[model samples]
Target: MRHDSATLIILLAVVALIAWFAPDVVLIVFAGCLLAVALRAPGVPLARRLGIAEHWGVMIVALVALVALGLLVWFGFATLADQAREFSRAVPRVLERAGTLLEGLPGGDWLKGQAQPEAVQPSARAAANFALAGVSGTLGALGNALLVLLLGLYIGADPTLYRRGALALLSPGLRPRGEATLNAMAHSLRGWLLGQMFGMAFTGVFTFLGLWALGVPLAALLAILTAIFGFMPYIGPVIGAVPAVLIAASHDTSLVPWVIALFFASQNIEGNFLTPMVQKQSSDVPPALLLGAQALFGTGLGFLGILLAAPIAAAGMAALRVSYVEGWVEDPADTDEKRIIRPA
Candidate 1:
């Protein structure tokens, strides 16, 4: 028992060391795993229906997705770029207006003092760069993207090979439990991804129509931002609404409320209707828990972590349920027989 405890401690220390030193690589690999599951989720069923091999199905789906995304970027890139530039130009003026408004309010002086920008120290700059390394527009980001794509393709093609290899690391008696835990984790991730994808689509479409109807400037850009931020769950929608609100306020104060209402309604629809319906396959992981994980992972692992946090939290919940709750915490007599999830 002491030996086992020591071994576990050593293993944990090693993992921590690796995480601390190679967080970007770790996150990229993690991204690949989630992408594999997401791609395979629809691929397998489609493959069976069309009498095609699983790998071929996955390749087709992935290629189609890539082609669609490429086309979107190809067509929308100019408009997105223009909107981005316009937003950048508008931000300072908006901030100045906000600053003016704050100056007229109580505690205005204190707020202004607090908001003043200080020169970034060298260490702080380094830390900032490290945090942003995953999307730094450097070779690192490209390399990570390529790595994830290759890993996803290989893993999605024949996930069982990787699964068997992972299971082989455990003792013969523990292999079954390990396999079960991994399967549960994958299912949880797949469900979470599906739900999130649907949520993003719904948020984007709703936001676009509402903003366009309201004659908001850069409606498409804001809608895309809304969709991208949807991945971050609770806080994301709020952050996404900021630019729209600022731009609207710049135009007309009356438009500000309309923008706010638009976002509020969109979020309501997503949180109340879209998420619950899609997340039926995903077991409940508390909202508070997910938010906490997002905070922690974002702090530790940066943007990629924030993007993937919901699924990560879902997988964590599944692991805890399978390994700790069912395996040891609950009485076996009271527990229902759990079925192992198999690859399709």
Candidate 2:
């Protein structure tokens, strides 16, 4: 027993070291696993209904997704591209306007002085360097995304292979529990992903309509950003709202209130109505814990960390409950009810 505990500690230490050294790689692999779960979540049931193999269902889903994505790009890419360009051009003007507004406020003279050539030159140089770095970073990110997609497709096609490989790493006595833990983790992650999908879709569609109704510039771009960021929970919506509010303030001060109200309404609906329905059908992560996880990951690992934080927290919670709580603490013969994590 002591030897086993030591081995577990050593293994954990090794994992920590690897994660510290290659955090990006770890995040990429985790993201791929998440994508795989998403693919399999619907595919498995479809396969059962169709009397087809699971892999075939996954393949069909992948193909359908690709086709849909291609169609969207074909039809909407030009408009989105134009809007993005306009948004980029508008941002500098918005910042300039904001600076002017700030200058009109109390302590404006000091703020104005701080913006003089001495401070501006270094910022300009930094911006140029950042732009250059950004190009390479974007290319690298695209490459990483492609890699993740391919990995996801492969794993989704034959999850059992990977599952068996993971189980093989454990002792024979521990393998059964490890397998169960893995199943629970996957269930939790799938539930989280499904809920996030609904939230994102709802937020994006409503936000776009609201912005368009208000005649806000770059509605499409802003909506897309809000939807993507919706994956991150509480912090995400706020980050997504900043640009929309800035643009609205710059375009027309009157429109700012309406834009803010639109986002607030969207969030209220999602938080109060949509999220509860989803949680009833899936695993629930406490809001406080979720936020804590987001902060920890965001501060430690940056954006990719923030993006994957919720699922990681969900899976981690599921594993602990299944492995430690149930295995060690719970009385199996007791009639007391316990929450079970399951896929929606």
Candidate 3:
């Protein structure tokens, strides 16, 4: 018993060490899993329709998506870059104005002081180093993007390979149940990816149109941010809307209310209409549970954790219900079958 206990403790320590040191790799793999689901979701239907292999169908769909994305970037990247640059320059002025406006409120003086930039000047060498670091970071991001793409392709091409390997970790008796749990988890993730994709697109399109109609600056950039962050539930939309509201407030205080109203309406539609319609087939998780998971994982794993928090929570909840709660924890104490089979 002591030997078994020691082995269990050592195994847990190893797992903890890996989690602490390799959060990024874990997140990257998670991204690959999500991409695989996204690819497989449409690929399976296309394969059936075209009488082609599922893998081939996935490749074709991926290629089409890549082409569409390339064309979009080609046409829109220049405008986005310009707007991003303008927004960066405008940020300081906007902050200053915000500080002034809040001067009458509590902590307003401290806030204004914090917003006021220090008079310290950096050397040209320091500026050069900053620029070099920015370039390095951009290149690193590109590298990570390529890695994620390759991982996704490999995983999506033969998902069963990985699934089989995962199931192998279980004892023979538990393997069947493990496989079932994995299938359920896959369904949950696939449903999530579908709902999330629709939500992001819906949020982006409506936000762009509404902001443009309101003549808001940086509307396109803001819309893109909104769409990307829309994947995160509850807190994401609020974070996405803040910049647009700030920009509006800087331009004209009156426009602030209009910008807020637009976001409010969009969120209402998303919460009431789009989410329900899309998530109907998806796994259901409580909002508070999801929020708690987000907070915990986000603190430990940063942005990637926050991005995938809901799916993780849903999957975990499903597994616990299936394998733990239903299987043993809540098993009936006295059953008719058991009583009848007892010794006379």
Note the Cα lDDT for every prediction shown.
0.82, 0.85, 0.80
Segments of candidate 2 deviating more than 4 angstroms: 1-7, 104-128, 331-344
| Tens digits of lDDT, candidate 2, 1-344 | 56655655676788899899999888999999999999998888999999999999998998999999999999999999999899877866676656666777798777765644344445778888989999999999999999999999999989889989987766666666677788888888888888889999999999999999999999999999999999999999999999999899889978988999999999999977897688564568888999999999999999999999998999899888877887658863452334443332
Best by lDDT: 2
Which 10-residue span in candidate 1 carries the lowest summed lDDT? 113-122
Q: Write the per-residue lDDT of candidate 3 for residues 15-97, one digit (tens) a residue.
A: 67877899788778877877887898888789889998889988998999999999999999999999999998888878877
C-alpha positional error of residue 128 in candidate 1 after TM-score superposition, expressed in Å: 16
Ranking according to lDDT, highest score first: 2, 1, 3
Choose 2 or 3, whichever is better by lDDT: 2
Candidate 1 lDDT tens digits, 205-276: 999999999988889999999899988889799999998887887666678889999999999988888788
Worst 10 residues of 2 by lDDT: 335-344
What's the residue-level lDDT of 100 in candidate 1?
A: 57
| lDDT winner between candidates 1 and 2 | 2
Which residue window of length 10 is worst by lDDT in model 3?
335-344
lDDT of 2 at 41: 86
TM-score for candidate 1, please give it. Answer: 0.87
